[model samples]
Target: MQLPIKKTIDSVPGGMMIVPLTIGCLINTFAPDTAGFFGSFTGALFNGALPILAVFYVCMGSTISFKTLPRVAGKGGVLLGSKILMGILCGVVLGHFLGEVPITSGWFAGLSTLAVVAAINDTNGGLYMALMGQYGTADEAAAYSVMSLESGPFLTMVTLGAAGLSAFPWQTLVGAILPLAAGIVIGNLDHKMRDFLSRATPVMIPFFAFALGASLDLHQVWQAGLLGLALGLFVLVVSGIVMLVADKTTGGNGVAGLAAASTAGNAAAVPTLVASANHAYAAAAAPATVLVAASVIVTSILTPPLTAWWARRVGAKAQL
Candidate 1:
């Protein structure tokens, strides 16, 4: 019998992403120290999710062109603005009521500013690009360049800062996407270089996904449980509606907008950064991180089918 593990994963909606991350999490949980054996190189490469993600961001950036900026900005701006609005909304509502800590009630224990903002702010850029490539145009996929600006904890920090929860260093905000900025510069300068690097964009997804998985402990997911699942659905419904409206307003049929609704895999890394930035978030960070990871998995699995279904509806209407 053939194992066909890759084929199996490729067959699922977000299988290519979800499968590797599942494997990485299992290895980290069971073997635990396996990442340390190879002179901690595995730790540096796989366990260090942020560094891996930074390189992946560069690859993603190289696919975008300055020539497409006008169209990309128009499309990307709406989605980005919608995401930012929802993120700030969630943060302000939670900060004002919950005060950045776990609510005294266990029912809301998994909810926190870090988890809420991170989940809402970041889009699954890889998934969006993939879906847009299938259902929309090249310009739609290229718009991910602007959306990618929401990659790290910077926006979450900004939202928190606005809510009076924490103050963030401006340099760290700029530092987060420096690789992406560099890639954009070089990509715009050389057509051949852009084409070469663009091919590598899809390859980087699973690579960085595995790295992201190493930081997760499955038990933490269990602790997050139902509430985390609810948060993911909440993101899909709320942000998904806003994006659909934005896409329609920007002369799109809503495919790209619905495609951008999911939480990004790298968002799991944000709570730690948030906690590091402000000691107040330290108590909630661990659980919030796990919750955000759960959101990533849930959203990744859910968004593609939703986008496809929406695409079909739009197509059917167009034919009518």
Candidate 2:
């Protein structure tokens, strides 16, 4: 008999991402003490997300050819621009109307600039690449290089800063962009090197997803409750729509846009990182982190089938 984990992982749409992530969340939740064992190497391997993602970024970058740079940049740029623009809009509108402590208001009472912006600004690069690999071309998956720039809290910081809510160090921005840039430089220079590293992208995804998920606390899902569910829907519906339109406008079917719609798994950490960078958001950080984590789970589940449906629809139309 084969491992059930493998069967389950292979069965799901974004199973490579969802399965490890689910397992990580379970470990973090039920076996919280497990993190304390082995001098905590298991915890570190699962929780040290940024460094792992940096390596993953390099591998992803290696797959993109300099010859296809324009197309990759174009698609990635459109998705990135739409994500950032939506984030900025939310921040500015909320900041202008509700002030920095927007959570005190009714209905949208549980939300704040940090949580909302972070959730919106980032895209699930792993999920997007997976979806694109299934429903789109290799170049479309390569577009994640651009989308990956939105990985950390940089764009969230920028959105909030523009809204008069917070400020962050420029070095944080540089630190986030460097790995992908290094990968691109190396990948474009050597074909053999690119081919070798490109093979590593799919293989590294589950590890990255596991690491990302380990950083999450499932209890956050409970803490976020209905509001977290709403945020996930907002990302999928609102941001998804914008990306879908941007995709079509930039000469794509709707699949790439839908693929780009999910909130990144790492986004759960953005609120805490943002709080660390700026004291202003410190009070909101804990709850915001939980809420964003919930959003990650929600988006991860929803985006894949939506992309597949759109892909099938587009394919049917083409056949017609």
Candidate 3:
């Protein structure tokens, strides 16, 4: 008997399942109780696979020379910084206005930071480069993608916490930064492992996505009605405006298309890390994770068209 290798979800990059998986989640409105329809095991895949694939993408460019980091960081640093600043601003404003109604400090921080995080995922950008036939835009996104691995969390915690949207823990900060350092090490020294993980990570996506969708009371995304619809529309409109401005400023580096399609989402890490520091927020963990999970599925579907449209408007071509 021959041993068989399973061709699970990992074999497909941008697959058929993503659409229904992403949009079906919105059905939580009509179904109200239908969250997690994708199941735990499938949810687990979404949770675990994203970061692994992220690291794998990083490894692909390790050979470009470590020295380029400064340049990469310099140019990409602005994008990351902008993300953090915008998140902080939004979190603070939303928190203050809502004033502990449906809003908690963590709520503000979570959603705000998530906006930026959701808007961008370093790993996803890298994966896009790997699978989507690298173009100038992909490379441009990849350049900054490396910087975002650590920066996303760092910015979220640092800015949000410091701004008082959430509490910041010294120990957790130290711990979180370690993975980024490790990512750099792995990115440079273990390209093969990085590649392997990237390839393997997709297997976990569905599981991750399903779990997040399960948390919401579909009624909230629906019965809450106009607010929920407005929220989604606001996110889209705001993101588009940001993309246009970025495109103009960057001389159409194609970074705008990438930035427009950031879509990293906070994933499990956002709530998990925040909850680790602020025990009061433990309940929010699931929602935060799910929010990010959904963001990714949606972004994956939205990014290509958004990027192309932005690219055309700005006259930028794909870089990587």
Best by TM-score: 1
For residues 44-63, write the lDDT of model 2, one tens digit per residue: 77667556667876776666
Q: Count the backbone clashes (under 3 Å) in each candidate.
A: 0, 0, 32
Local accuracy of candidate 3 as per-residue lDDT tens digits, 1-320 = 85433344344333323332444456544554432566575544434433543443343333333655565554455555555555666666755654212333432433434333333322244434432353344345445544445333555566556545656678877665655555556656776755654454444444434433444444333333333233334544554556445544655554353544434433334544555555655554544554444455555555556656655665654545
- The 10-residue segment of model 3 with minimum total lDDT is 98-107
Q: CA lDDT of 86 in candidate 2?
A: 93
- Tell me, by lDDT, which candidate is best: 1
The residue pairs in collision within model 1 are none
What TM-score quantifies how close candidate 2 is to the native fold?
A: 0.76
- Relative to the true structure, candidate 3 has a C-alpha RMSD (angstroms) of 6.9
Segments of candidate 3 deviating more than 4 angstroms: 1-68, 99-139, 150-152, 210-229, 253-262, 265-269, 287-302, 316-320
